[model samples]
Structure formats: C-alpha cells, structure tokens
Target: MSGHSWLLKLPLGKCKSTFNLEKAVCNHGFFMMAPNRWIPSSKILQRPLRLADNTTSVTVLISHPPDSSFLCVQVYHSQTPSPADQRAILKQVTRMLRLTMRDETIVTKFQSICPEAKDINFGRIFVRPLSLKMLSSASSFAIAGKRKRAKSEKLTTHEANNAAPMGNFPNFEELVNIDESCFLEKFKPILGYRAEYILELVEAVKTGRVSFQDLENSTEEQLCYEQVYQNLAKIKGFGHFTCANVLMCMGHYEIVPADTETLRHIRQVHGMKNCNKKTMEEEVRKLYDKYAPFQCLAYWMELLDRYEYKVGKLSELSSSRYHLISSVLFQEDTSNK
Candidate 1:
C-alpha cells in the first residue's frame, strides 16, 4: 500500500485501538493502538492476526478514526501465536510509544502531546525470544575471567535466524520435549507443591481419561492459565505461583507464561509490589510505553522475573545463566521439532 500520510490520525486523549492484522501493513506504518505503541518495520509489511481465539484470524484493518482521533496498533508476534500474546504485545506497544514520544510531554505519559505533527519517527523494533538463551545469558555469572569488551556482542541476524527460524513459531507443546524428566525437574521446584496435581490433570487429558478434542472444543474444559487457575484453585496444593507455573508449561493448551527474571525487571523498573491482575495489567501498559511492537515478549519476561523475585525465587539464580540455559534449551527443543 502507498503511504497515506494524510489518512493518519493525530493524538487525542487516551484513545487506543487494536487491529487484528499486523500493523506494519497499516497505512501509517506505525501501528497506532491506544495506550499501546508499536512502530512497524519497513522491511516486513504485513502479518495475520487471530481474534475470537483460533476460530477466526484476519489481516487487521486500521482506519483513521472517523473524527479527530489518535491511533496505535498492536500486533502479535510468535513462532506461532494463538492469541495468548495480547498482554505481551500491549506492553511492548506502550513502551515503544513512550520512547518515541518521550520528549513531547512531561504530563502526558502515553498520550501524544503533539497532535498536529503529521509524521513521527520511531526506530526499528523486534521481539526478544523468551526461550532460555536470552534469559540465561542475561542471568549468567561466568564473566569473572573474561575481559570486558567496549562494545556489546549480539547474535548476528543470520545466527538468530538459524537459531530461531522466524515466520510461524512452534506451538508450546511442539516446542517442549516430553521425554526429558530432567527438564521437567528443572522447572519442578519452581512449579511448587501443586506440581503433581497439575501433572495429573494434564495426564488425564493426554491419556484420554479426558477427551482431548472434546476439551479443546469446550471453552471451559480447555486447559490454559485462566481455566487451570480456576480449576486448580478448587484443590489445596495449587497456590498462585504453582498455578502460574503449571499454566506456563501447558503450552498451547493454555498460556499464562511469564518467567522469573522478566518479572524481577518489571518490579525493579516499574516499582510494582504485587502481581495482582490489575497491577500486572498496569505494568503491561507501562511496558508498552517503552518497547512498542516487540514489547509483548519483553513485558512477559520482565513480569515473569518480577513475580519470581518478589516471591524470592528468581533472585538466587544468576540472571544470565538462566537466560543462557533457557536459550540453549529452547533452541535445542524448538530446532529439533
């Protein structure tokens, strides 16, 4: 599509809208979803967005608000997304908008102060992988013997392509190795006492005690963070942490996945003391203020660490080590799949 500069809307008060399609294809190039900010890349133009769960996915249609309106678009990025990335994308968009408009206002945090400025320039953006390597790398402590380099070393885009293999991402189940008991064990301590309970529940479905197709068909029966949270809450073993971890492991069956280090970063940077849904949502908005578009994964990781650190679990582990472990593990598992 040709640039529709005049079609772009100007900033108004607290107005944000999300389109189902990828924002890069939208006229503005900068996806304008209120309260969330995602700057689109020129290299890639469009992507699909799934809405109403997996029942429907569409190429998003973003329009200039009928009246005087401010717009922002949030897009879901995944190896393969099934609508669970909303919170992460929201956070990223918020951060990107904040960074792009940072100089514009002191009072208006996320809302743009410059409503009249026709063209705003926000830089290149991409999502950070939540699999083990980046997190483990961020948490690693083996730097004692190595000399410090003046510049940071990043994975070459080519290496990243080999490791991550962009485009459609793998679903959660496909990404994890079920045969590795040790893998389960690494996540077990973090799973808390409710581990056995969740495992039984998953086994029931996997073993056909509960029909998989039936459960996936039934909105209420399908296992995921929200459903599992409600189901496991009825039992005694599943506390908040346990339930959250189990939800993370369920893969495509359910997703409430966020890790410990990311959560810690959110708490430290955003000053959130509790992990209540509202507070978490607010933090998501704040993250959108900094890291638009790719902020979803960034938000998830930061919040994961925040939750873990607040509960004193993630702090003990070397941040980069965990990131490296997760990175290598995620890569190994995903690549083979």
Candidate 2:
C-alpha cells in the first residue's frame, strides 16, 4: 500500500440529476442515516483502481456539533483504484480528515462564510466563556500569551461543571457580556470590537441591570437603530461598529444566516416568484443537500439576487457559479463494490 498526500480538484461531469457531494462522502455505502449535508471535507483522498480509467477527488468538510471546530479535507487522484482499495483508502483519509478538520482555524474559516458572520475572532467568539480558574490555567494562554500549542490542544472545560478553560464555548450573547475594561487591560495589544466591545457591552448590561427583554421591548422611535448602537459603543473601551454588532447579538437585528448567493439565485434565476421565509428555508435546505451545509449559502443566494436585479433574469447567475456546482455528478462503479 503506497501512500502520499496532496490537494485535489473536484472532478466534473456526471449523470445523476440529484448528485450530492456531501451525501456521497458522508453516507455509509448508501445504507446509513440520512446524510446531513455540510461542506465536504476540505482535504480529501483518491485511490485508483488498477483496471479503471478514471480520476477522482475526495473532499470532506465537517462542522462541530454546536460548539466544535470546522474540519475540511480535499483529496485528488489521477487514477481510479479497485473498489476494495478505494474503500480502505477512504477509511484512512476520513480518519485524518476528522482530525485536521477539527483545527480551530478551519472552524473559524468555515463560520466566516456565513452570511450573518462579521468576522472570526477567536478570543471574542469562541474563548470568552472561560472560568477564572480555567482561564488562568488553560484559556488565558490561548487568549493572552504567545505560546504555540498543538492544534488539537484546545481549552475546553468539563461540560457538567465549570471545570476548564474552553475555546468557543460561549454563545454570541455570552460573548457580549464579558468584562471589557478588564479584557482590554489584560490584552492591550489586541485591537478589535469583539475583543474590546463585547466585554464593554456585557459590563454595561450588568451595571445598568438591562436584561435582554429590555432591548427587545424598546420601540423603534424610543431607541432608534443608530441610538441603540451608539449607546452600546459608548461603553468604556467599545467601538462604534462593535456596539452595533452587539445589539444584533442581543437579538435586535433581522439578519437571516445562510450562503446568500445561492439562495438569491435559486429565487431570481430559478424563477422563484415571491419567495417568502418558508420558501427560502425549504429552498435553502434543498441547496444545502446539493452544496452541503455550507455557511456560504447566503453568498450563493445573494449572487443570484444581484444577478436578477441587474439582468432582469437569473440566467446570468445560472450559467456560472450556482448552475455549474449544483448540476454536475459523477457515476462511480458502485456495481463492482
């Protein structure tokens, strides 16, 4: 069994009308659970059958269950191996893919594609829920110091107890409630709203006893968007843009998250007239089956929307990005294996 690793490109052309990249990789020989779509691994492996005359690329992508890292693997091959060998190589590739996809950087990169996502700030987004003890011993180093640890060496606390410092454990709301001044004092060199503003907003709420309900109850006239966002920013150490983002975190915004481009195209180009929330959701889910559960679905939708807005038809958007990726399929010799 000779072995080598390299990044591979996706092979084009297939006949299946509903060709699913995510399902093809994630399923258990078409006999497993309904494949929940997501990005196929960024890194993949390809093994060629000695008798077959085809090239293959196996790409894999995974997301954490709620608060886990994103995993991606992309494998390319210039040959097609026998069915038995292909299965064996796939098992090995998946094992490594699982580990590499868990890298914090990979997770952040994946989330960054979400339409609602503003940025990927490790300290503010994923590592702020650390307990004092856990922070000092585990999380503090990740957020404060300059030491390099293995990618897998994360700072997570026990689930049952506030035992260890964890990374990306805190939800968006929790991130907004950290101590701003204290965080700034500890990590002065850091310069961003998340690291700085999130803490400030949290402190303001605590100091003023402003529960989440208060933010929601306030009227459009009583607390205009600009006013509310500005108030959030003025908290000691918070910036203007950061405060606006915090308000959204507090459930004040109507931002729908997905890969905007594909969604937009599905409607505009695909002749989806008067697409409502439910329609969008269903279509988005279907595309997720096609594209996998990518956070960038919003991007795909947005591109379609823009195309229709400009050309008065979805054809422009259809001919390129969305159409190409969504339509093609590969006919592997499942009959042999």
Top model by TM-score, which number? 1
Give per-model TM-scores. Answer: 0.26, 0.24
lDDT of 2 by residue, 129-222 (tens): 1122221222212233232333212212331121121121222233343454666776556555455544554555656644444544442235
Q: Residue-wise lDDT of candidate 1 within 1-337, one digit each (tens)?
A: 1211112222534322322123212222122222112323222222223222321222222223344345433232222323444433333233333322321232132123222111222211222222221121221111122222221122335433422211222222322223335535754686764455545644554454544344223333444345646654544455655555533332221223344544544455565646444466456556554533233324444343333443333323332333443454344334533
Per-residue lDDT of 290 in model 2: 36
Give the CA lDDT, 0 to 100, for residue 105 in model 2: 34
Overall local distance difference test of candidate 2 = 0.33
Give per-residue lDDT, candidate 1, residue 278. Answer: 45
Clashes of each: 67, 51
Candidate 1, residue 81: how far the Cα is off, in Å: 13
Q: What is the C-alpha lDDT of each candidate?
A: 0.33, 0.33
